[model samples]
Target: MRPLIRPKMIVSAVLAALVLAGCASTPEPPPAPESTSAVEQWAALEATELIDQLEALPLDERPRDVLASVRQDEVVVSAADGSREVSVPIQDGHYLSIAPYLDRTHDCFFHSLTTCTGEMGNEELTVRIVDDRTGEVYVDETARANDNGFIGFWLPRDVAATVTVTGVGGTAEASVQTGAEDLTCLTSLQLT
Candidate 1:
């Protein structure tokens, strides 16, 4: 019985050693550097140049609610055409105004929940506006024909508002508040 116990003890020690060897973690290789072709580099620089030029223009000349950043993946579909990706970002309680590439668009049309577009014509679109604070509606008007496809309306400075727009051809929504200054705007994006 003692001799049998010695052999069992030796086998147990060997098994423990094998288990420890298998538990060792392997070292990972360093990540490779990002690759950028000449064309891609040039395109990036061109985009930067365009942004700089646009920044130099007066605020009025710039597109309304020009999204500085985006938080969620967005899909913009057109009944006439196909679709595109639009990632719009915002600060807290801020909204965006989007032009569904449709004829009717305005500064406040696409951004808050207070308003939404009701109907559309060959060159016109309806919009509705909602007040975020009291959950009251502020506007529900169909806009006149627009040369541009869309426009944006920001919250009155420091005021909270949410706006959403939906129709068969398009849909957009955002949360916003008038920020620190009278003209500053902020927004947030939510996925459903």
Candidate 2:
């Protein structure tokens, strides 16, 4: 019998090859914050920008020697093996990165921007977010999970909303808040 080949692995491999070949296109990056070094400039970029840049690089080019974490007000990038660090402030709204899982998940409060994984990686999903109290729709679009199997969202600050994600396995719903105290890593939305 042929060895088992999961569809997800194939997709992930294709995506990885595209990234390694620099065929995956990202929007023109905005002006970098004034800094002394390239790493410093990258570290000072907004959360989305940093993630985009990191995703665009070839595996060998990424700062694998560093680490990433989210705080209530900022995304922190620091050298994993050293003492260098930078805090990129959250601007405009709250950055909420979610990894909706199907079969497994890990306990996460603040998202590890560099290393969190979800079961539904490399899948397309339809996500919709609506204001729970005012009935205002915030987001309704098709989103693709990144290499890490996570989709990040920027929500209006301090609002309570209902987040519904539709994936291949099924749909999942959860309540979310974009407050100063809310968790940044949302991983409990298991598709049923």
Candidate 3:
């Protein structure tokens, strides 16, 4: 008897061929262009100019000073735990205070078989200050909180700067502007 071809086998072969052909004939689409806002475009331009200026300078010679472009009466302080916006007064020769607290939490799993505990503290924080105009690191030191749970820094008149604080709890950053006229204490920053 002549060998018989099964209909199911023919159908399976045809299906397999169709799938392979479909995959082989498919073309990948081009990547989409990145969308950017007006602010982003301006920032990109500024960054490019900065890079070019730096590249032109000699290896040992530092780049030109970058003036503080943005001025604010307040700054947003952020940390891993939380964030807050603190207002700073435009006054010269004023002290800025920051207060942070410690919080504790515990987690238990599997009927108390597994336990995890953590503490967040804002003590002996590493604080840094940068001069925006000159691109210089003005201060980098550890700030110890007083008994009242506050850390203070003196600000010079007519200066704009960025401050960064880091501790076991988290980290925070802010930009501030000092008044042109010398004045007494007026500004404070609180982070928790």
Candidate 4:
């Protein structure tokens, strides 16, 4: 038996739609689902699975009441108002999500899986990431931005590094730390 649609294709379609919707303006934040069961369903999903779904959903289909953020140690899934929540420990490598922008950006302490926006959506940019201590180059290639105008990386846990993103806007550099208490979202870089 074969699946009707490949999972990658579904995700790509969703991302392309988001990028198109955001090209002229930022799409409205996903509204909370009407049923609390939506949150429960998300709670049942494993960390990576949950992250994948969260990254793939369209704004209208997202459960707005839940705020999902990935961190160094675990994924925090909670109600937007903080009335309920859960944490799923990360079992392996660390994943970092970054949104590099030119003129617009938002104040995000943690990257929200349901809502976070950046400029230059659907752009293929040159990205370079290096370990600050080991002098190892983790990534030296071109990565295309998802519809949300962000790129993600999988790295070994417990390290600090510098990140540079170069695109049509220009270039920008920033630092990242993957520690027990470090944030998983990087949106401070700006193209000059």
Maximum-TM-score candidate? 2
Q: How would you encode candidate 2's per-residue C-alpha lDDT over 1-192 as one tens digit per residue?
A: 899999999999999998877855676899986756544766868777886666434434556667777766887887776578888886678777778888899988888766676777678999999999999998899978877777887788889999999998899999999888898888999888
The TM-scores of all predictions, comma-separated, are 0.31, 0.74, 0.36, 0.72
In order, candidate lDDTs are: 0.39, 0.80, 0.43, 0.81
Between candidates 1 and 4, the TM-score winner: 4
lDDT digits (tens) for residues 104-174 of candidate 1: 33443222211223123223545566778777775566654223333344333355665565544565566
* Best model per lDDT: 4
Candidates ranked by lDDT, best first?
4, 2, 3, 1
Encode model 3's per-residue lDDT on 1-192: one tens digit a residue.
998999999999999999999999959888987984322332334322422232233333431222112112221111222332222232224344444334533321110100111122225877787878987776789966443333446555567788777776566676765554322221222334
How many pairs collide in each candidate, listed in order?
A: 38, 0, 0, 1
Candidate 2 vs candidate 4: the lDDT winner is 4
User: How well is each residue in 1-192 modelled by candidate 4, as lDDT tens digits?
Assistant: 986998999999999999887896966899987775556778788887887777756556777788887877677888888888888777887878888888888877677787786786678889898999999998899978766777777778889999998988799998888787777888888889
- Candidate ranking under TM-score, highest first, comes to 2, 4, 3, 1
Candidate 2 yields a Cα-based lDDT of: 0.80
Query: What TM-score number comes out for model 4?
Result: 0.72
Steric clash pairs (candidate 2)? none
